[model samples]
Target chain A: MSFFGPGHGACPGCGLTIATRNVLEALEGKCFVSNSTGCLEIVSSQYERSAWGVPYIHSLFENAAAVAAGIELALKALKRTDEGKVVVFAGDGATADIGIGPLSGMLDRNHDVIYICLDNEAYQNTGNQQSGLTPTGSNTTTMPAGELMPGKTGRKKDMISIAVGHGIPYVATATVAFYADLRRKVKKAAEIEGAKYIQIHTPCVTGWGIDGKQTLESARLAFETALYPIIEYENGELTKVRKIKDRKPVEEYLRIQRRFRHLFKHPKGQEIIRILQKIADDNAAKFNLDV
Target chain B: MKKVVRGFYSIAHSVKLCKPNVIAAYPITPQTEIVENLAKMYSNGELGDCEYVTAESEFGAASILVGASAAGARTFTATCSQGLVLMSEVLLNAAGMRLPIVIVNTNRALSAPLSIWNDHQDSMLLRDGGLIQIHVETNQEAHDMVPLAFKVAENPRVMLPFMVNMDGFKLTHAYEPVDLLDQEIVDSFLPPYEPPVYMTTKNPLTFGSYAPPHCYAEFRVTLQNAMMRALDEIEKAYKDWAEITGRYWGGHAVGEYTDDAELVVVSMGSLTGMVRDVVNEMRREGKKVGLLKLRTFRPFPVKEVRNALKNANKILVFERAVSFGYEGPVGIEVKSAIFGFTPEFYSFAVGLGGRDVPREEIVKIIGDVYEGKVEQGFHFGTIKEFEEVVV
Candidate 1:
């Protein structure tokens, strides 16, 4: 049976929907889902009509990981470990911003659950606000590109490194552009035991100001430009890396999205683009992303 | 079995008898010992089939209980003061989702000048948070209210969260002889929790769904109706426990010397004990004074409170917490409960921030009211001068 049903309120070509479907489809047996208050929860479970075909719950925004820990422990206490694996689906804002404390708590306790961060960069549910995962030089509602400031001035938070720093059993990064790899990472993480974190780069079509048809392309460009790395860690050691072939320039990824349009138009736009390229070069050098 | 133990220990023993599936909490002041004792019991293998998790914060603790309860498990946690304030958001979520979780709130003073002492400020702040709130007057009552709270909260008619409030330093730190209920008797009184709908693969149900303006009010109305239904459920649980244990701490609102009394003093929590003593002393001196102890604060026990105080000519409500711009929370509710029936009503905020509420103070307040020295509005009792410091 399909894990996620139809009639969700997700926008057309929504990368979040694509990534969520891929992750849920990868699960093997019975599963329970704990969702944070975001686009995924709002679109999927609207009152009496729910798009979830599995047992699901949505508590608050910042407590999804803690709630999942509780579900996992309750299952063990009830002697129902064979019932299902507990999973959490949260946004980048919920994972890297308001939810970091509870996320750290869940990891510290090493609860047997998988936490999936559907990273849409910004707070898309709240109308394109700047979140901890919002990349530098990207314009958002909270960090608009004005004459005084170009856009967000800081780099995107390395949430994968933060997860790895917890020394969890499994940590992986994926994007909606690579569906097969995304599913493989989820399936692999599900096989492991202790706390697991997987952050998926799901591009927001509305928030990114990209065409509905260009969602997958935007995610792919993010990976091809080495701006978003596809890497995995096992036992706190870097285990695998998806090598980039025929690397694309950072401008190819920046020029298409309106959030980054200011980066090309401003007088110091090229300077900022050069800085973004230097960031990608640093990521490539750090993760050895070259094929 | 009768044993002299700390109030927190008695509560832990009572919770052990209840057999909760999940217990998650963080340590905070007077509320720490209860969870510490429970953790010790878990280590000793006395708590069976329980997952005891030490949460990072009170917010995480309350959220953990929310998920555990939603997953068809009986769950519990404890917090007070700032911890309660931190858990306020999740507490509302638990109530809104109709999770039958029980929490012990060792009522303490809220921080401004920062004092960790006994007061009703903590639980009073969440008065409208939709949890079924009960205030205990003694250690024994605190011990008994655990299973009683779970019984009412898990009742299918009233699937709401329950908070058992006991004065922080007054009841939590004091040692008292409590007749602990036997495991078999507790088992008979509170059956294993059977949730009507929970997260299960076979059922595949959705919980905590997004509600639009068209139906949000309806969900709130449903919760409010369940709270109203809890009034009867609380009474039934008390009767059932009393049948098995032969100890009843009065249903909702308890009365002492209230019949044909000229003056009635209304209060809650451990402060009622001191007020009861003052009432007894006044009675011996030929003064017709009585005491009305409010047991349940959320539903307010409006009918019972009105019935107990209607015969009295003058009603004095004393509370440890104030509503700041308004008056005491319980006093506000009590006034509204008996608005037309009472002609002389006086509300007093006393013993705030764990200041001593001696019997003399209670007697003095009563004297002032009877002698026409106190007005018909809210008053602050037992105000003392602080040492002047040149900063």
Candidate 2:
């Protein structure tokens, strides 16, 4: 049985929706889900209509992990831990920025739950606002590239490392393009007993100003360019990596998305391009993502 | 048996007797002792089969309790001041989802100068959060109200959250002789929570979902109806507890001694204890004055308020919080309740931020009202030096 159904409020070619579908499909419909306030919550469960067939709760914007932890503890209190899986869904803004403290607390407490963050790099639901996960040299509503300042100043927050630092049993990164890998990671997290975190690189067509059909292509290029590396860690130990062979240059990924189009315009644009390439190079070196 | 204990221990002892399945809390000043005592009990095996969660923040604690309560477990939490403010969002979510969670809000002031002192502003901010707000007078009532709050909130007719407001530091730190009921009696009085519906895998259902305007208004109306129904449930719970323990106050919603009195002073929470003493002194000296204590603030008890104050020749409202530029929080509601009545109304903003309003100070304010020296609207008795300030 499918947990998440089709035909809801999700936008066309929404990468987060694709990743959510793949994750829930891997669960085989035996789970209780909690969602933080974001696009996924707004789109999936609007008024009388619900896209989720499984038991679900949508709480505030930054408390999904805590909510899921309570559910897990409640199930344990009722002696029904084996009956279902407890999972939490949140966006990058909720996970990396506003919700990081509670998310860290849940991991510190070692609750039996899975926290999946659909990282679209920026806040796409509230009209593409800037978030902590917004990458450098990308335009968001709050951090627009103008004559005065560049797109975003800093690199995206490294949430995988934060999860690993909590000494959780499992932490992984995946992209929507790698459906098999995403499914495998979700299933693996569900099987674990302690806190598990999986961050999925979800490409947003509207936020990035790309064609709806180009969502998958952009996700693939993200992986190839080492901008969104697929890495897995088990109990603070790096266990798996998706190495890139014939690694594509960061230019290929940047050219298609208009969020980064301004990086090719002004005299300062070339320098901003170099900064973006350095981020990719650093990730490639750190995760050994290049062949 | 009656024992002299800090007000915080009374709350902890009452919670122990209530036997909640889960308690998730973060410590804030004036509210920390209650959670600390519970944590000690959980560690010492005195609190049985309860999951005591020490959350990262007040927001996280409130969220945890909401989830636990929605999952069909009896849940509790305690917080004050900024902690309560931080949990404000989760409070609305819990109430909207109809989770019968019980919380003790040690009332404290919001900060610009950053003081962890007593005031009603914290709980006043949550007046419309759809939870039952009960203000307590004595430490015994603070103890007694815990089980009562749980019973009323978890009742099938209500099924809404409840908040018990006790003045921060003033009552929370005071030592008093509280006659806590026997464990057996408390157990029989407040039964285990059995929610009609919950979040579970067996019977899958969505909670806290997005509601369109059509569906949203109905939920709000339903919640309001539940609040109204809670008045009866609260009385029933109190009556049932009184029948077993022989400790009945006038009513669960309000208590008044306005009969045969010309002037009535209205107030709530621990501050009422001081007001009651002052009124008693004034009565023994042959003054025609009485006291009206508001026990319930959310369901408002508007009818009781109007009925209690209707016969008085003059009415005065003493409260610990202000509505910024307007009257005191409770004062405005009291005025609305008695709109058609013809008592010369006066409101005094007093005892804010844990400022001790001694019996002499209360007597002076009453004395001013008696001599017709006070104006028709609001007055600040203690802060007269800065009465010219906007608030």
Candidate 3:
């Protein structure tokens, strides 16, 4: 299963590399993939032997979805649209930020493909810069640790909800922590008609300033604290939610990562904790997350 | 073979003949009637096996057409000035991807002060886009242009999509009878579009990949070469189409009605019809004059133009749009096209922003150019207050 062994160009505990390698491991068929120009592409595709085990291509940041859409149509003309799942491997910088129009168009037009958004918060490939998915109170290079206010101005955008609104048949949320769930979600998405979107939370080690080995735990914390609630919408409606065994307070989640260390500047940490709680509460109200 | 029809209906009827598998268009004035007729044509089984998406916006209409075209379907869409500008990005994407999509552009004036009238600004603005642009004059020409456009665009050697342009309100709403071609002939002439690749997860090929600076530059140059190849492909299509209809309405790839004369006038789009009338009047008067009607602008048939103007002493260019702060765009291009070769060129930048250019003005232009009264370079169709310039 671990075709990408220890010797890799990625950072010691780069969650994205692990997640992408693990993500491709489930493919039993020869699939064509479009990779967005980001950290995943830069590290994995160094010159000759791209870490990609399958046929992987790359395009511009904004046109990732459009490129994949083209490949999908090409397969259909050849009567091979169903042979393998055409997927786009892009990050938050490419997905929610730039490639939204093409992605939304593909979903609406019902292109037969799967698009995976490997969310590592900020634009990690460009050196710990803020992105649309970067949450509030998280200090990055742009949103510096300051005394007056927090790191990111607003909360992370509701991407999964927007994807659902596009009326794609399958839309889900997963994390690198839950390998089994991530694989299952991707597989399920590929086996359907029309475009599918899956958002995976892979904590960036350098950006998050956390222990490399603690990547999985950080992913788990995102879910347990409900800071990054995992939910799915099928055919434009709420259909599934991943069950969290023991929900923890948002403080326990934020206090672990150095990115969120700014919130701990005050001992009480009451306001930032409530803000995280409000995010979770809003999501719960919005999607009615039972699990 | 002729039937009485409105300009817009001519376009709609011609679209029906091609039988586009997907017709994604939203109605906008000066161009709405055609799609309205098409939406009906698609719905009534007259145009069979087509997906007619009544899009929410011009942007959606454009994107939908791109998706449908990429999905290996022969697609059609119609838009005017604002709509065309709104769909600008997808238009570039469509041509860049070599989609071979044939779209109808009802040429309308771009708005800021919000004026919707006949102008070539819309199509002229897209002259640099990698697509064959054919301007049609009459309703019959509009009808005839569609079939040939599809054939040229989908040519394997020149897989550049084409946009057939007609003056908006001037032509789109003007009802005129056209000798519509038999659908069987159109079907036989225009074979179904089969793109080299389409959207599929299986056997995915790289499309729209960022070629590192070196490859990127080469790709652009190659695209330019393909556009050049389309000239021959379009001529070939015209040759084949002529056999069926016994009419080569494409006339000259770069039109020249009476080229072997003292002076030559140039025009494109419905304006050509006006030029033709003026030329006929001048011919009867024993005045040795000719008219060069530009049909295909993208390939910019410089060689043909030079040859047509070879015998002529004075060559006048009547442009419908201005480049602002410069001479007319068409005049500039025509001048650049014939750069090294010297000709007594008079660029009459006229009929801009829906301003009317009467036939008398056209006659006066020929008279002035011949008399050595007109400026040697660009003129804004200005007339001496001695008289109002006629067409």
Candidate 4:
């Protein structure tokens, strides 16, 4: 039985909705989900079916982390601390912008909970607003690129690095692209005694301006190109790199989406591609993926 | 016995007496001194058996309090200006989830113009944020409001956040002699928090829900009903405080200063002291003027304001902050408090951003309202007749 529930209302190719179902399925109803206000919140929690068979709480866009901390405490107060898991789920916008305070606080306090940031890379709920997670050379509604240059200027925040920086018990990177790995990591987090962090590479098809069927394809391409490398830390030490396959050139990942079309628009097109290549190379070295 | 302390320290002194189990806070201007002092006390062993959270931001501070309180700890937090805005999200979570978190905000104007001093804008903005709002007139009231805030907030019927505001600079920086309550008495009177359900993994539960529309609408109604029922809780809290301190917070929303007279000047915050003196001076000169100092801003004590104000023919509302497009915020709220009874009021916005409002100006405002010269309203210390804009 699906622990998150039946008839999930996620859009046809919504990676997050699928990822959430996978998460709950892995936890097997021994979890309390704290969701932040975002696209996932509206779709799954709107009118009728909750889509969540397990208990869930939705706090403000900025406070899901804090509420999750409260849930962990609730379990302790109830004297069932060992029997269940506490989970905080949010979009990139909430995790990076509004919910950062509580998230950081949770990590600092080393509260026993798994904070899963579903990085679809843009503020998909507010009409594709550019968020802190938006990769460079991508067109968000806020940072729409045209003939002159590529899209978003900055690179995606190294959230896994940031999480590790907080010295939490576990910090890992996984994706809906790798369901088995995702479930394994989630279960491991639930078993840990303190704060755990996971960055799930869930792509927003509509926001990314890609065909719905390309959801998983793009997710796989992302990891293959080193654009989304999967790494893990234990006891605050960088320990593992999930060596799955060889690297694909970064341009192959960018070519599929119109949002990244600006990167190939002009004389500076090759320059943008070069920058993207450098990003992938950088991730490869930092995460020690080449070994 | 008298002890001199800054408004912030005075608040801290009382908080120490209350003996909170958790002091969760991050620093922000004006109000930071309170939390900083508490942290010092917690570390130096001046306070015992407490967890002092050195948090990341105001939001985190509020959240830490929630977590600590859920773990059956008495908690508190202090913030101001943008910190208040940042805590906006946590504030609602604290109230809606029925967490009795005590929040102290030093009144500071919100950003755009970026003045970091006295203004009611920050506290006024959260007037409808499902928290009990108490504005203080002096260090004594600021010191007193905390215990009452805790009692009112902890009453299960009103398990929401409560803001005890002490105006920045005017109160936060000003030093005054305050008679602190004894710790033994406080411990005996204000019992420690023991929640019915604490946050634990042992027996898990969720707060806040991914509520569908059917459930969402009902929750809002429940919040409304709960807030309405808090009036009784506030009274009971007051009664409890009175039994201990012998202070009468029984005036409902509006505190009186010769309120039986024909002319009443309505005001809030520390400005009440100036208005009180002006009204009494006006009364001595055979002028039928009085003052209504509002201590409670939220749940707007509608009944006492109307009953006490019914005898007045002319009412003058003095607000320390503007509402941008509308009339003075306090003036608008005051008129709404006595709406149907129809007390003719001249609303004024004055002394925003720490600009002083002298007693003479208050007397002039009272005279203007009495003589019906304030056609729209008045703005203290302006080039021309700065009346409250009626939109």
Candidate 5:
């Protein structure tokens, strides 16, 4: 009983496609979804055709959380709370950049909503622009690897910690590579009574210049290298972490993607690679990701 | 039923009587009292089954209303000036989606060298944003326009967003005698909002879909047709409310006083009150002067405006907002409405940025226009002499 139907216009091996399907399937049609302006919304809900089998709305780029909050309050006000949960799907740019203010307001209001940030790391829909979630040493159209500069010069914003700082009832991180784990988080978020936020590491094949079939492989490498931690929090307390049995090096994750291919050729490439490794090391230490 | 109250309190009471399901608004000066009063009502349990949300920004407030309205709830919010500008994107989206939401805009000047005072520049900036815009003259009219706005907006034939514009500090802060509508009468006038289609799990629906170039213009045409249809809905709402309360603000759109008058003053918002007084005083002196209060700004009331001013020899179109390089917005629309009817039309930008439109100023502008002392084009009504500044 999946709500996200097929025949949509997502690119081949689109990670958002897999994450959207997994989240909707976990909800089992007992949710109303609002989408921000992004690849998922444009592809799934073009006029005269919609891929959503559940009630859906796409208002604007930055107001999905606020809109979902309105939906939650409306259902409560209309005495239709038993109908379904209210969920929002926004891209990383929508979540961390243009939409952060409204998202924080929604969480601050503690509306009964599940906000899912489809973190493809960059604005993949708009041809791979640099987003707040774009990691360091990643090449994007806006932040290209020129002679003087390496790749992106900043680290990915720690959005999970920001969500936790809002003191919501539930906050978690998942990856599209791990469908079962992502589904479990969705179900748990649905069961929570207050605001819930989940940031999914949905790797972008086009943006990362990876092969179409390597979307899931890239997602797996992201988590396995400890660069994208899979962790959960309940009531602002860390409750779960996906520990790695044999943690891979960050070089293995960076080498396959063309976004980081420039890092190996540039004179200052090794230093940036070392910086990326230290980020992964910090995440592993912070989340206790070792078996 | 008559009580003296601030304009914001009157608007708040009117909205409460209409029984909105969701009220999400952020506080802005002059517009803050309306939501604050509503919040107080909600806290006091006067607003039954209503969800009151204090949004972080006007964008959030307008977006919440859009979501609630899409979910089949009667929703509302209020904003002005910069706040209205912030909510511009979501407001257009709501109109495109044909969501029947009512917004009360306490008109204020736009910023740079910021002024929170009364002006129509805010609402005028969104003149073509696909929302039904109606201006009010006094606090009493502002109170009456809320339920009427909701009725017209929720009319299945209309199903468009409505914006009721009232001057910021002029009407919002001023106390006036208002005859509040009884809840029973309001409930009978505006039935429960039953949208044709809405977001529900039992029956899924998609809203705000992406339109290709092949069909985008058609959707916009549909919205334009909805605005055109709103004219009739506004008339019907006005008729029904007048039937219940016996208070008619105007006929269709323009409230006219052109009884065989040659010079007719055309204006909207609270400035109309001062113009009305000036016209009455001039009429007592046997001068051929009259006033046309523009109630509905959007859907321009073209037919009514042309009909009302066709007999006049001189038409003075006064407005509080300018269109920058062009003339006053209302003045441009008026000239366009009666293009062929050459009646020596004069455009005047007056009372801008909270400057007071005194009765003397109104009389002086009319006198200047009638005497042919001012040009036929746009003219600033009152400009103070410049003072030396030691910058």
Candidate 6:
């Protein structure tokens, strides 16, 4: 659907732009959206020019889920729930960092709304600052690779598990490369009657220091290495897992992005890469992603 | 119907009368009773057709109201102290989006000694947040102001959020006899909230968009103009509300008893009641002292204040919160409003951190200001005795 219109102020091949478009397309203009302050909000709805044809609101960074919850309840209060589904479009920073509390609140209240986290893994809107979702061994502006310390020291937060733990009706993870899978998940989540969450592995061309054309390729690599598993859950139960038909080593995924360039060159680089590989292996083992 | 009720219950009863479709709140002290009563009313089916959400945090409470308001519902919330500070970001967002959500802010001191005491610090922090801030002295006024606040805030000319501030614990826990309006009057006075901008499937529109520097300034100017226009809108609401309810606080941003006075005392919130009492005592004693109570702090009522205070030989200002290293927030605003007036000015910071502002001190402060004793800048009223410890 062209509801998520073109000519948005996003970087070329920005996976977030693609991801948001896919979500809106999946909804097919039958939803009211609440956007958090992030790359998507900044790029798509700047002033007089709006890329969204659907009803939308961009209110604060950390309260998209909370706002969407209100929208859902308000719709119910007005006896207008049949009007459209309510959805929150936010970033990893919004869903996993500062906004996590409000997101948790929304899920706990079980508002009939869908929350989508476009996980670019850093604060791309603020020029690549470190976020809770910035994976370990990855370099962000605030977590620069230095002589004293490596990249982001800790592993990325397990936001999926957090959402699932809330006992919400539906939770899923998708990527821009898996358009059909992403659209299918978004549509299914929107159709569900209770709180839902979808975390899409959105790759940032500018923030990730990758060529714009490699946006999909990078997102695909993230899944192929089992670093970001494309999985779905219903009512706290794992329902489906997108098996990796051809698994690649984490290095293939890391090598293309400059954020991990220091990991390949430093004396401790190889060890860090091995640890990252182990992480992917663990994810694969846990989610049964390997074919 | 008049009932003897705690201040928080009065707030709850008033909100119930307005029949807000959504009331989202996170439990915070002093303000908790208001939501507690609201939840009870919802459960008992006394407050009909309302969704009461017990949000996880103050942020959740405020954000829920913002979303609910944007989705075209008459939304309400109650919070104070840390809760108000926590809701600060959304407070700004609610105004910027012109959502017209009504929030009752039970004023309390901020933390770092972690005090839950009554103070003006919380509401004063959001003075410029593009909301119609109405600070009421009595529980009755707090109750009366809710529907009027909604009317003013939702006015097409002033599509801004509204905050009604009552002193936490001091007023929220105090008991008062309030003549509550019936649901019929409330419903008629405050029509179902219908916003021009909202998230509806039938008519799609984007709200809270990113404005470039050029567009951002215009939006801010619009908000400023809207806030300015709120003064008249608020008066109009008062007039309409008075016609139906047969109750009207004077139109000059609250009652001004300054017509036949040689000296005038200024204050806001619950402090005004005591200030009025002191003025009455002085009047009986043949002293020409009167009180100017500020009800609408935002849109500051500059002209009314100047008119009421211009004739006085001296003006004494008492405020409940300090801005730290400067005059009290209300005193500073009063100074800015009456800039050219030649009255002997004394700005006193009193009752901070919930310290009692004894009636004698108010009398003494007035006496000092009249006798040319008090200094011009920020004066610590009762805390002056414990200067070493306070400073």
Question: lDDT tens digits, residues B210-280, model 3?
Answer: 44454567777878999988877778778887898787865444545546677788888888788888888
In model 3, the runs with Cα more than 4 Å from the true position are A1-116, A122-131, A140-149, A163-170, A190-197, A204-215, A234-239, A249-274, A281-291, B55-57, B64-71, B197-202, B250-260, B381-391
Residues forming the 10-long window of minimal summed lDDT in candidate 4 chain B: B198-207
lDDT of 6: 0.88
lDDT (tens digit, per residue) of candidate 1 on B169-280: 8999998999887899889988999999999888898899999999999999999999999988899889888888899778999888889888889989898888888888
Model 2 lDDT, full chain set = 0.88
Fnat of each prediction? 0.78, 0.69, 0.09, 0.29, 0.82, 0.90
RMSD of each: 1.5, 1.9, 5.0, 4.5, 1.4, 1.8
Measured with C-alpha atoms, the lDDT of residue B338 in candidate 1 is 87
Error of 3 at A134 (Å): 2.7
Name the TM-score of candidate 2: 0.97
lDDT of 4 by residue, B1-391 (tens): 4688889888888888877777767888898899888988987998776656677777777766666565556778889889999888778777777778888999998888788888888887887788888888899888878888887778776777788888988999898988777787677667876676654434444455557556877877877787888777787777878888877655455645445687777878888888888777777888888778787777777777777788888788888777888778888877877777666668777777766777777777777777777775545443345689899
Comparing 3 with 5 on DockQ, the higher-scoring candidate is: 5
TM-score of each: 0.98, 0.97, 0.84, 0.84, 0.98, 0.97
TM-score of B-chain for each predicted structure, in order: 0.97, 0.96, 0.93, 0.93, 0.97, 0.96
Each prediction's total of clashing residue pairs, residues at least 3 apart in sequence or on different chains, is 0, 0, 21, 18, 0, 1
Question: For every candidate, what is the interface RMSD in angstroms?
Answer: 0.7, 1.0, 5.5, 4.4, 0.5, 0.7
Per-residue alpha-carbon lDDT of candidate 3 for residues A19-137, written as tens digits (9 for 90 to 100): 77666776663466777778877776543435555556554556567656655654554455455777778899788887677677667777777888999998999888888898877
Q: Model 6, chain B: what is the TM-score?
A: 0.96
Candidate 6 ranges with C-alpha deviation above 4 Å? B254-257, B384-391
lDDT per residue (tens digit) for residues B242-306 in model 5: 89889887754564567688888998888887788888888888888888888888988899988
Cα error, residue B123 of model 5, in Å, equals 0.3
Better of 3 and 5 by TM-score: 5
What lDDT does the true structure give each of the candidates?
0.91, 0.88, 0.76, 0.79, 0.91, 0.88
Point out where model 2 deviates above 4 Å. Answer: B252-256, B384-391
Q: Candidate 1 chain B: worst 10 consecutive residues by lDDT?
A: B334-343
